[model samples]
Target: MEFFTEYGEASQYQIEEIIGRGSFGVVAAAVDTQTGERVAIKKIHDMFEHASDGTRILWEIKLLRLLRHPNIVEIKHILLPPARREFRDIYVVFELMESDLQKVMQVNENLTAGHHRYFLYQLLHALKYIHAANVFHRDLKPSNILVNSNCKLKICDFGLARASRDDPPLAIFWTDYVATRWYRAPELCGSFFFKYTPAIDIWSIGCIFAEVLTRKPLFPGTNVKHQLDLITDVLGTPSHETLSQIRNEKARRYLTGMKRKHPIPFPSMFCNADPQAVRLLERLLAFDPKDRPTAEERL
Candidate 1:
């Protein structure tokens, strides 16, 4: 990080405290020397199996460059070592955000009005803007969302992000980095389709929404098979066409084994769910990704 030492801002940054940590890297709070501004410094985990880990770094750059929404997190710049070392990687500089939705939900007693709807609306706005840019944020859980100075929501963590810009209008390809198990979408449960699309991100948004309402994860399944069971158990088995898209034969067999068209109809989990909220959840938890609503269409 010596290269960053002369960047001036980082040197003056007091390293107030450890903000958070994830598989990708450690987040630290720092003060800027040039302007006395507070910023969040995300130090990327450099010890990747190969050099390909830079893909997400590139994604953060591309996504930030294109998206300029009030709700989305703004990236200051990407920090590199001007000089290199064996394990040295890069860091992304962003204007500091004070709180994340997850923490706010826990601490605030009156979280229903300004805190809730404001963040939700901005989140949806950001979602729509990026989706229009053909960028799919594969991960949308609470920890990834940060609250800025004006109490606006800023989305972060582009590690699992993918783009629809690949040419010939290609499908939103699937990746294993579907955030956490609880936030995982139903369509991803049994598929390995190379053409997985942005619809999966919608399913994740639904999960996050439900989690915010209940202050707990909606489908906190233990494993992949269990995750599939939970999703199938909720939305019912997907159609043959949906099953056909998945390349994994095991996924096909699993779908074929379900004799009932709507195996999930019975045994309602949220029996007391409000009609409006239930409808939203249904749209989100749909077995077929095609059936799920786009992030923009939430309104």
Candidate 2:
């Protein structure tokens, strides 16, 4: 396993320590020698080892270059090693954040209602910008949201994002396994052939919001079938029209055969939650994608 000791010949940045690591790559904390600014550098491993992985990495870079919003992580620099064609690692530098939403929610016991509302507001503000750019994040979860002690939030990790056009080419199809299971939208879990839309991100936002309030995953399922069951248990089974929208025959039949379930009232689900917050959550988590409110509408 190789690790970076320093970045650039002039020692422009000094690697302090690794901040996080996941299947995608490793993120490290570093200080810019020129300006004495802290930055988080993500070293994407094996980017050029596979064509598909390289394409996704390139797509993420493209989207990040196009997205410019306070609520979205800013790319400070892109570093490529010599022999670019054969270079296996891709380094992307971003402004360092105090922590991610997941870690903040875990350790902060005295979080107020105001904290939750502000985080959600920033997320929606970022989503509105991304959606306006005709791009779907496809992956939105607590861990993907960065935060600061000041309560500012920025959305990150666009590796799974997809561009959405008014009429996307026929060859373009969204991958079914995009978002993490806990934050996945009903449409993604209910059918593999479901048409991808920005609504999926709204549903994920609803899940994240619920977690922020309760400090637990809204729907923690072990498998696809179990995931669908969890969703139905809360929002109730989809109507015949909603079921009909599922393009995957197997998934549609499986849903149709399930026993009917009455929807759980949002207020009851989110005990003591403000009525307006509950209402917004319900709209965001609507079973039908068309029924889900747009990010701008939620704001």
Q: CA lDDT of each candidate?
A: 0.71, 0.85
Write one digit per residue (lDDT tens) for candidate 1, span 253-298: 8777865645554226555445566566677667777788876677
In model 2, the worst 10-residue window by lDDT is 1-10
Superposition error at 134 for model 1 (Å): 0.9
lDDT of 2 by residue, 185-263 (tens): 8778865453577898999999999998888899999999999999999999899988877888889999999999999
Number of backbone collisions per candidate: 2, 0
TM-score of 1: 0.83
lDDT of 1 at 118: 64
Task: Write down the TM-score of every candidate.
Answer: 0.83, 0.94
**Cα lDDT for residue 94, model 2?**
93
Give the residue spans of candidate 1 off by over 4 A: 1-9, 45-49, 80-87, 113-115, 148-151, 166-174, 192-194, 259-274
Q: Which pairs clash in model 1?
A: 13-31, 172-196
